[model samples]
Target: MNLTVDIGNTRTKIAVFNGEQFVCEEKFEEAAPQHLLDMVALYSPDKLAYCSVGSGQPAFETALQKLSCPVLHVTGETPAPVTVHYRTPHTLGADRLAAVVGAITLQPETDLLVIDAGTCITYDLVDAAGNYLGGNISPGVEMRLEALHTRTARLPRTEADGETPDLGYDTETAIRAGVVRGIGYELQGCIRHWQKRYPTLRIFLTGGNRYAFSNAVRQNILTDSHLVARGLNHLLEMLP
Candidate 1:
């Protein structure tokens, strides 16, 4: 068994995998030593793969060490199952790389556009030849809403829910429509452009806000909430 942990900006995800099959997963607002200890007790995984975008927490690291498992901290320089073409590989996000690897593992040799809508909206592409071409990043839905509230005095920080209209009828609705619908259109446009370039391109959507915009995205898209975990598991398999 293998354990994969992804510590994101707002949440931490832990997944247990038996070979290539995902057994179970858990999410926490933040990772703590107790959380790691509990998972270790439950799964007793032989190998662990971890990736984080935030500063390392010593307590959590200590807990992982106590697990007595071979822990692989995924970095840009870490050996990946895919070829990285980014000019500044060191600056590439570990989550993004893991997501690409997961996509390839799921679909194998096919052109892929992996969209992760989490703290940020990231679009990473992997060619059929397994070369990872860097993607773009934009402010996420929550960030957009927060930015609107913070940047201006009158605009309120509104939560995105319900149906988004093409145009806003009032102030609150207008903000919701602008942020949610605007992102929907942006994602659709990106998918369309990629499809034109790679006619057989496969689109995969994941991350926190995937459900928020999945219905609005106008493409033959596949959604997997556990992409990063799966990718981390795949990377773990690559180890000797």
Candidate 2:
């Protein structure tokens, strides 16, 4: 068995895989050492792959070292199946790269647009030849809402939940609808923009906010919440 850990901006995700078969997954507000240790004990995975877009907690690092298995920390330079075309590969986020690898793994030899909507929304493009062409990053749903409230005096802090009608009826609904619906529009526009260039493009949506905007995207798109974890496992398998 293999274990993959993804520490995101606001949450941490861990998954267990039996070869290429996904067994289970868990999420936490933050990566707690004991939680991970318990998972390690329960799964008894032979290999572990980890990547983080969040702060590298020292305790978590210590816990990882205590594990008796090989641990692969995925960095920008980690060897993977895709050929990276980004000018500054070192600056690319591991989660974004992992998402692309997961996309290609699921759908090979095809132009892909991997959209990961977590704390930030990322759109990574990969050609049919497996060249990662870089991507764009934008504020996520919560960030957008927080920005609206913090950056301005009158705008009230709003949560993502609520009826997202075509137009908001009240202040809370308005903020929720505007932020959520705006994201929907942004995603739709991006898909259209990419489609013109890559007609055979296949869209893969992942991350927490994926389902929130899935219905908004008119085109056919594949949604996998565990994309980054799957990709991390794939990279572990590729290790020489």
Candidate 3:
């Protein structure tokens, strides 16, 4: 068994995978070293791997310091199954790395567009030849709402459902429509642009808001929430 930790900007997802099978999965506001150690002790995984985008947390390293098995800390330099041509590789987000690795593993030998709809919507591309082309990033569903509230005085904070109506009757609904519909168009535009360049590109959607926008368009998007975990497992498989 193996443990995969994805420490994001706001939360950390920990999962126990026996090969490709996940026995337990959880999301935490933050991961403490002791909490990670306790999980390892309880699950007794043979090895552990973690990716972090957060600032220096001594607790995480402290817990790994005690581990007897291989403890791989995912970094920009980590060996990937595909070739990355990122000019500023260090600036690449860990979440994006995980998502790209996930996409390549899930559908090898195919052109891919990995779209993650979370606090920030990211669009990453991997060519059919296993070369990772750079991608674009933009504010996500919630970030758009928050940005609107902060940018203007009269616009109240809008609450979002997974679905936003096109013809909004209220202020909140209008915000929702503008944000959600705008995002949908933004995503579709990217797809169209990429399709013109690479017609066979397959679109894969991941992250928390994937379902909310799944039915908004028909772009052949595959919703797999466990993409990062799958990538983590694939990374473990390639370890020497």
Best by lDDT: 2
lDDT of 2: 0.91
Clashing pairs in 1: none
**Model 1 Cα lDDT, one tens digit per residue, 33-113:** 788788888988999999889787778877776668899999776789788999999999999999999989999999999
**lDDT assessment of candidate 3:** 0.83
- What is the C-alpha local distance difference test score of each model? 0.91, 0.91, 0.83
Model 2, 141-228: lDDT tens digits are 9999999999998999999988998888999999999999999999999999999999999999998989899999958899999889
* Each model's Cα RMSD: 1.1, 1.0, 1.7
Tens-place lDDT per residue, model 3, 1-240, is: 998888877778888888867677888887677678778888988888788878877777777767898888777667888788889888887678778888887798999999988878999999999888889999998899999999998999888774477787888888999999999888888889999999888999998888777876477778888788778766876788
Model 1's alpha-carbon lDDT is 0.91
Q: TM-score for each prediction?
A: 0.97, 0.97, 0.93
